[model samples]
Target: MELPEPDTASDDAMDSFLDKFQSQPYRGGFHKDQWEEEFEKIPLFMKKAPSEIDPKKNPDLACLQSIIFDEERSPEEQARTYKGEGNDYFKEKDYKKAVISYTEGLKKKCADPDLNAVLYTNRAAAQYYLGNFRSALNDVTAARKLKPCHLKAIVRGALCHLELRNYVEAVNWCDEGLQIDATEKKLLEMRAKADKLKRTEQRDIRKAKSKEKKEQNQNEAVLQAIKVYFEDEDRAELYQVSPKSTLLQVLQHPRYSVKALTPAFLVCVGSSAFCRNYFRGRKVHQVK
Candidate 1:
């Protein structure tokens, strides 16, 4: 492409601008009040970079900016470029910007499994640093789908599971990572930690279940005794039942069947205020 010749007409204009500078010094452009506009134009003072860079407005940056996301490039190439940009941001610890760049790379939907997996894993790292563990885990899952034995993805997934308190799942993921690279130190350490947590959780569960079962058995025993005393009259003891009855089932039962009809004996089943109150409230014959 031929470079456009500089307009000679601009020479006359440039001379006039220089002539004005020598004749009547330009005060308006140099004034402190006009400096605010210049400050606003600088990127350092600006809150954010312009989304759209106009060549006329930013001629210096136009070429570089245009080349950064050239529409002529293939999606795969564009995605790769974005990955590089993301990596730069990641190295600088600008994780939020890195996540945005990686997301843009993924949006390209490149057919290269390796490139896509890398983008996913990189995004997972950014999200992880940003405290979005679930999002990081999801990105890790995507990376693993593209490359099932991805050690980084496995490590990230295990970490996410650990944060979420899914100790068993974390151990499983750590195991998967160890399978691919047995010598990986991170995987080894994570697996050991996760395994310990999983075992502790299981032991606690077992203890809780055993204690619950014991309590249930005791409650069932108490209920069964109550049933025998109230419904199965023959299960009552000799003094608990009518003193006239003669049955082995009466001597074998453990429930209280208080207030015998005869005065020969008083059935006071040990320190039971509830039973005493109930007996007092009853209209049945009471023998002192």
Candidate 2:
């Protein structure tokens, strides 16, 4: 039975229909226009994405600086405000933010050395929490330079050095702090820790040196034994003993055998005798 040439036209038309049907845009999802309308409701300040906010030129930060640094506001008051903000952040464990606030307070450049010292010390605390030990040390140094007797800065400096594995520097800083307040418990504790670590490090070094020396001495002793065996004339005479001599005959020889020698010397001389017998085709047991 011959099928009619097959309805090519109808087949092409059906495929076109299926393709267009599937290709139509889905109407079930929210449209771009609806999303745009919702987005417009957000406040302008809140609408600025994090990527749009420049760290160095943030508008909120600029506004904060303007308020604090106003000519009408006392410098001391401004510094205190910034310090308080930093303290708040520090209490929240936001150390990087605390550092920023403390730094802003310092930028005010207040005339009071005590206030500046406090600011520097506070920033050092933040830096320490952030694991910037070297930076913390630097801040503490600045604080100390401004007020030599600042106990907090001195203690913080010691702690920073301890974190950096600078035991000697930590001890020195602790000593400096103790000079100002002899009964400071924190300084005493830090000094003790540094001293203990230093002692442990020194003990390890001494042990390593002792082990190395012992090994070197053993090696030298072995070399010396070999040298003496080769150089001693009395031992060298054993080489002239006849290969045909029995084991007991060698030992019984009047001039060859000796007594009261050290174990190491005896071993060396015995090894030489064994080698001489081995080379002359005498069994080792035959020369006992």
Candidate 3:
């Protein structure tokens, strides 16, 4: 859903309120005759809608700003009031409101850059709770960009990446964030989980490969053992290999010792001598 454009009516209304105070000695645009009437009106208007607040109607901002910003209120009182508002919303888990309260309370106007980072981080967390992942990610990114070392924003950004199922990105973010807050337990856990998942996947592939290799090796070993046990290992090797004059040369070339025999000689002796004699003897005696 699209949000409505910001209403300018409040600011426009404020302009009219300020015009009446231009030549006034005090704010609230109240003259001597109007003071009592305006005093009675403030309490009634304070109970009305917040967005409807107009200095012209009730003059709370003017009065409050005067007391809060003026040298009138003790510094401690001013601080207590600001902290009270911020703490109220913070305890209520209204982080967006708390952030605004805290921001407005910063007495040092030059401190806004740091304050903005805190506000952005708080609102990002609230957005995350509201299931606005993209908005949360944007706020965190902005906060980090403003203050690159913001540990909260970095951790939150990594968590958002995890929620989004961008595991690689999540791991990368956590890795970078860990540099800033090395003791961040949550980030460590997230990176550990991602690492475990990656290792598990690799283990599965390795297991599959090992199973295939085992099957292949078993089949090869069985074939070799079968040839040796039944088919006369010698004769099978002789048939598989060509026996040329090189065989006779290697076998009778007495210059070479039998232990030094080539693989061709071993095959010829193992297959031919035993198997050929047995077969020929069996055939000759079988004449009928």
Candidate 4:
């Protein structure tokens, strides 16, 4: 199919190019008589392959696309084409487009385990590059399910786990991978890093538990040492108490009426019947 001439730099350049194009006789070498090939050499025709065909604007590009995407191709063949397209985008570092292409390949349901696994793994790589660690992890899981022991998927899954700070899981995944290939340096390194982080996390948890236990013990001791007293006007007198279970015993002591206190001992009857009937049972709690 024929493509239009390349656009020129300016009006003057366009007029000059037209004059030269019209006046010159055919002396083509490599692209002799191949108009599409010659037009492609202009860096304008199909330089960026159209994602969708538009024959009106880019007939050559559209024709190229139509030829490549005929109905004769099977689902598996189309899927493999998408996979190759994704790989090309990946090599160019166009990760977002690569992910789109890979996702399309997966949607084909090619019924080819190897192809599907590779598609998932490739899409996972693209997702990882985009900083979608959880999504990348999910893709790796799908890839692994399709083909267990897929080394690239295992490596990518471990990386995602590490990024998500699932330290223990990262270590376990690395270990699983190492079991498949003990000489894998990437797995060995990841395992070492994950194991160290997991150990640190465990140590920090243990330290926090110990500190909490110590504080609790100290608070309990303080509660045990608090002395009970009964105040009569401004004169305070000690109330009988035991070292252990002092508050419990005092609250649960045999019935004692606040009004029955000796004149020297003063106790106000509380508003509530339960509170007035029981010895003052409110606890002023303090925890360290």
- Highest TM-score scorer: 4
To one decimal, what is the Cα RMSD in angstroms of model 4 from the true structure? 12.8
Can you tell me which runs of candidate 4 are displaced by over 4 Å?
A: 1-55, 222-288
Write the residue-wise lDDT of candidate 1 on 120-225 in tens digits. Answer: 9999999999999999999999999999988888999999998888998998898888889999898788888988988999999999999999999998766444
Query: In candidate 4, which residue pairs clash?
Result: none
The TM-scores of all predictions, comma-separated, are 0.61, 0.54, 0.39, 0.63
Tens-digit per-residue lDDT, 12-74, candidate 4: 788998899889965765565777665764325446565665577666666666776665888
TM-score of 3: 0.39
Better of 2 and 4 by lDDT: 4
lDDT of each: 0.78, 0.76, 0.63, 0.77
What is residue 184's positional error in candidate 1, in angstroms? 0.5
lDDT of 3 at 242: 27
Q: What is the lDDT of residue 163 in candidate 3?
A: 77
Q: Lowest-scoring 10 consecutive residues by lDDT in candidate 4?
A: 229-238
Tens-place lDDT per residue, model 3, 1-288, is 999887799988888778866756564467788776665566555433243346777566667656655656654455455556666676777766665565555453334465656656766776777677777798889888779989898888888887776667778888988998889998899998866765776788899999999999998766543321112233332222222334444444323334344332222233445646644533111101
Point out where model 2 deviates above 4 Å.
1-66, 69-77, 216-288
Better of 3 and 4 by lDDT: 4
